[model samples]
Target: MIIWFTTLQIVVAVAAGAFCAIAGLAGRRPSDFSVGALALVEVLLIGQIVMAIVAPFAGNPPSGDPLEFWVYLVSAALLPIGGVIWALLERSRWSTVILGVIALAVAIMLWRMQVIWTVQVG
Candidate 1:
């Protein structure tokens, strides 16, 4: 995985998490801004996925286990998609809660990705 993209994902996830938390605490539903933020994240994730795929074939394969890398890649790509669907369906504080949960999950995945890459590199 590209460090830059991974870092970007983490930053996006953190920002999303903060927004979700604020919304939940304020007893407000998720706003269109939240959805827009998530949509932006999804777009970035798509780019990251494409980069990952191309890098491997272009002789820059990740040092991590292939299975683990692919799993992280797929799940990372899915989080925003899932968040969008959940937000649209719920449209309440629950939507923000869902986003919060997904953001936490994304953070964990990013940490795991780092660990996996580190193990391989070392």
Candidate 2:
């Protein structure tokens, strides 16, 4: 995992979490802005996938265990897509909660990916 991309994912996840928390606290449904943010996160994740694929050929393996790395990559990338689908189905505060959960999970996964990378490298 690229350091900068991982950092970016964490930041985006945190922001999404904050938005979800605030919406939940207000007893409001997810807004278009929240959906847009989630979409942006998905876009970034796709970019990360592309970078990961290219990194190996570029003479760098971001993660030593490509299988583990791809597992996290695929899972993390799917979260946002799943969130959007679920959110569309549930438009209330529940959707916001789902978004929050996804964001938090993705953040954790990113951290795990980094740890996996470090362990393999060391």
Candidate 3:
């Protein structure tokens, strides 16, 4: 994974996660703003997917097991979707917090994926 892009994803994910968490703690219910923030995170993940597809072809293949990288990528990509679904179904303050937690988890997973892509040795 590209350092700059990974950094960007982590930053955005953390920011979004914090925003949602604070909102939930303030007794706020799931709103468009929270969902939109997650959508943005999802968009970044989609970009990461594209980059992952191209990087190998561009001679930046993973130093670790490609399957491990892919599993992380796919799982990270699903977090936002699941979070949104949970919010929609639950429609409570806790759901908002869960969404925030999911975003944070995504951020952590992205970091792990970066390590798998560039640091870990197979």
Candidate 4:
């Protein structure tokens, strides 16, 4: 569990969420940049997935419920892809808002996964 890496992911996730939210609030459908930001977030999520897989081998397995941790990881990874598909179909500012919500969910999920990775409390 790398602190700075998690922080970077959180920042990107939050920024994507904020960008989509603001665009939606301004009555704009998802722009190219919006999609790009989400894509970036997806890339980070992929990185997280890799980290999760390799960490166990590195002797840094999750300290909490492994099932919960894996669930968060998988969900966070899927959120952006789902949002992208939804946005493509909806084609409205509302779609952007939905994407915004998804991004926020990813952020929260990532934070939870981090806790599950780093914390040892029962």
| Top-TM-score candidate index | 3
Candidate 1 on 90-114: residue-level lDDT in tens?
8888787777777767767876876
lDDT of 1: 0.77
Which residue pairs clash within candidate 4? none
Model 2 per-residue lDDT tens digits across residues 1-122: 57888899889988887787678667878788778778878888888888878877887665467788889989999988888888888888878878887887888888888777656663
Can you give the lDDT of residue 101 in candidate 3? 97
Candidate that beats the other on lDDT, 1 or 2, i.e. the better one: 2
List runs of model 3 lying over 4 Å from the truth: none
Q: TM-score for each prediction?
A: 0.85, 0.89, 0.98, 0.95
lDDT of 3 by residue, 66-108 (tens): 9989999999999899999989999999999988999999999
- The number of the candidate with the highest lDDT is 3
Off by over 4 Å in 4: none
> What are the lDDT figures for the candidates, one per model?
0.77, 0.81, 0.95, 0.87
Displacement of the residue 65 alpha carbon in candidate 4, Å: 1.1
Ranked by lDDT, the better of candidates 3 and 4 is 3
